[model samples]
Target: MTLTKDYKVLSCDLDDTLLREDMTISKYDSRILRELQKLGVNVVLSSGRRAYDIENRFKQIGLEKDGAFIIGSCGCEIVKVDKMEPICTKVLSNDTINVVVDYAQKNNLNLGRNLFHYSIFISQFKEFYYSTTHLVYTCQNPYNLEHLRITNIQPLKVDYEAIRKMCLESPPTKLFITEDPIAVSSKILPEISKVLPLSSRALITKAYFCEVIPTDGGKGPALQWLCRNYIHCEMDEVVSIGDSANDVDMLEMSGLSFAPSNSFDVAKKAAKEVLNWSNMESAVGRMVNRVFFNGTFLMTDEEKADSKIE
Candidate 1:
């Protein structure tokens, strides 16, 4: 099959979809990504991660200097990967954040503050560290509120009522709430959906956390935006591959979607095709070879067998 030149962009989610379990990109995955880009496919990283966090990852992969676009903070911020320039940004007002923080303190609930292009702020440093270890490595920056730079703190207040109001009113691109995020997300996602908006989707990357991103923010809108605004391609020409609930939107939105064997049922249902192998087995590289390069590539027989097995 000849791949179309019309699709020039491949927008992808970061955590469970693109990055491996160790939070590192595999050699196979990176080679495939670079090859795809050389074939004229623009790879854009889209995630609920903060822009700085995602930027650091891309830098690790040597893609930070390659002119990719990153949609971070659940679409609240969009930036150019090469220059690290902010293309657009949306922040909750300071007064709004303060109100939410005050409420959380009064209720004895933990709250995390996401600073713009800086570190996150929290009321209890221990709670924050325990909750966000997978996403953020621990920092020595003193938890003392007095010592930390006030300018870097942009507090994101955590309150269900306030969050619900925000959802009803302005509606942030994403919102999430979990009592024990690590325990609830991976095992029981449908149950979590009970409290969340039906229109929105949920993804659990870390054991204790679940993300509530825009129904469109999934790989779909990110790809759509890249196609229309950046690469000027059509939706039907693009192809996406992923696994898990977070990959659902992108799977549905892409011209063609592929899922690994270990993917969640919801993601499998949405995928156009399911790869026989899982991410641990290099499914990403196999799919890229099949779709983009017409199958003339290096791959293990197990991988090839898996691709054709089902």
Candidate 2:
């Protein structure tokens, strides 16, 4: 019943695992995590999201002082939630950034930004993914400029100077290129990978998003680093939860792993068990209940079908 039997540290994805589609944490899930933290468990947020966003999320749930750590930028950086400062970081070299920019410009492909705290994405076309009203995803808008801090990349000519300056001044912690998911996966990624310096790496985080970071940066390795350097625990004391292709490595590295019923195939395959509820239904609370209390982790087929029921 006690987590002392296994995990001492927990790493969870931010978007789909902990936060709801509205980017808010449920009261039930928050209560479970806060209670677990009070019981001496180290809960960490692992995400491709920027450090700024993670800090704000912790602030939103009043966990900024609850003893938390963030493996941000898909493991390119780590920050302490209490301090709001990066403990360690890995960034793509300036030379590498220039190379990528040059390639994108020559090909007329739009690339995202990787600033110190957040990533920037501006729609270069009318139908870009982040612009999807159904998705409601954006780092910056005029109403919340201070928090979003994203560099607009629209109206190509106007943004050119600003974009160039940002690249020269900001070393990318992790950069992304957004387009038609189909084009990104099929033609763009393969062609770019062939030219990137061997020191850099790129992968698909979403259908319309391809993330570029240092070759050594990965969420699993970052989790390992956190265990060794920050938490002082063995890999066996760690638990990971995630829900996408990007979360595959972190899921694989954990002593215990779980994915929502609605998670992608790869993430589910990486988990030792699947939760009875999906994220919208607060699957995270159920996961914590199973881990820290005498709670069930299994689901019947009917219950599974009902996970999607409104």
Candidate 3:
């Protein structure tokens, strides 16, 4: 059955949801999104990525020029693209940062491995930081670095002293930690939670990444804030697409939600529909066709027959 409900806002996650496996938005998908925006839909790029990273990469699609919004850092930041102005932001307090520092020093989960435990510092500067004992060094999450190559933005390395100074002088939007997936799940996750204040929260956004931000900040809350104050839309009128645990909040709140076939179980369970196609197969484009174009946009008979990925 064709969907009859009206949808005004299209909130989409970037990685493994709207973007292809190649870390780019396909031409077909980009065209569909542009068309949706032209039709007066408020297209929002909601992602766990930093706002700069999202804007730098997506500006090529011209969504910013069309008055789109960006909810970045998994919801710690919200920006209106056209004006390049922040609508809302949440930051980890200095006390919270101090606590995290102490925890990291006391619990050296990666001690003596000679391997870097990369972490990102999200703020005015897009910097990547890592630590060994009491000394902090510059590093990059190799996976994130691959994506940053698209933007040509260099990852800055800083010392532990620099991080401490920043925390005291100007708090950051959030702190990101990346390490071995097994260690992240087993050790880092629980220990970090215990050290953080009730006002601060840590969540595993990906298999090897844990992000710390203000307790009130998250994709769900950010979506709610935008709808209530700016977009003036109901949660039920929003269409959300995501593929990770971090997307669960926004997915559950949307009236129409989708997860790609390759999505994590949590995302699939949260979404109303799970697409047949994976990200590499133009999942976003297919979903756009099915929902907005009535399953006919750019669909050849052969493609339609092969729509379901085995």
What lDDT tens digits, residue by residue, belong to model 2 across residues 215-281? 8888888989988987899877788888876788888888988888888787889888877777887
Candidate 1 worst ten-residue window by lDDT: 128-137
Q: Candidate 3, residue 299: CA error in Å? A: 4.7
lDDT of 1 at 40: 64
If the candidates were sorted by their TM-score against the true structure, best first, what order would they fall in? 3, 2, 1
By lDDT, the best candidate is 3
The residue-by-residue lDDT of candidate 1 on 218-246, one tens digit each, is 54666567677766778877777766666
C-alpha RMSD between model 2 and the true structure: 9.0
Question: Which wins on lDDT, candidate 2 or candidate 3?
Answer: 3
Cα error, residue 25 of model 3, in Å, equals 0.9
**Highest-scoring model, TM-score:** 3
Q: Give the per-residue lDDT of model 3 (tens digit) for 76-115.
A: 8887765446779888887887877566546532211011
TM-score for candidate 3, residues paired by index = 0.81
**lDDT rank order:** 3, 2, 1
lDDT per model vs. reference: 0.57, 0.70, 0.72
Error of 1 at 30 (Å): 1.1
By summed lDDT, the worst window of 10 consecutive residues in model 3 runs over: 108-117
Off by over 4 Å in 2: 1-4, 64-67, 114-165, 296-310
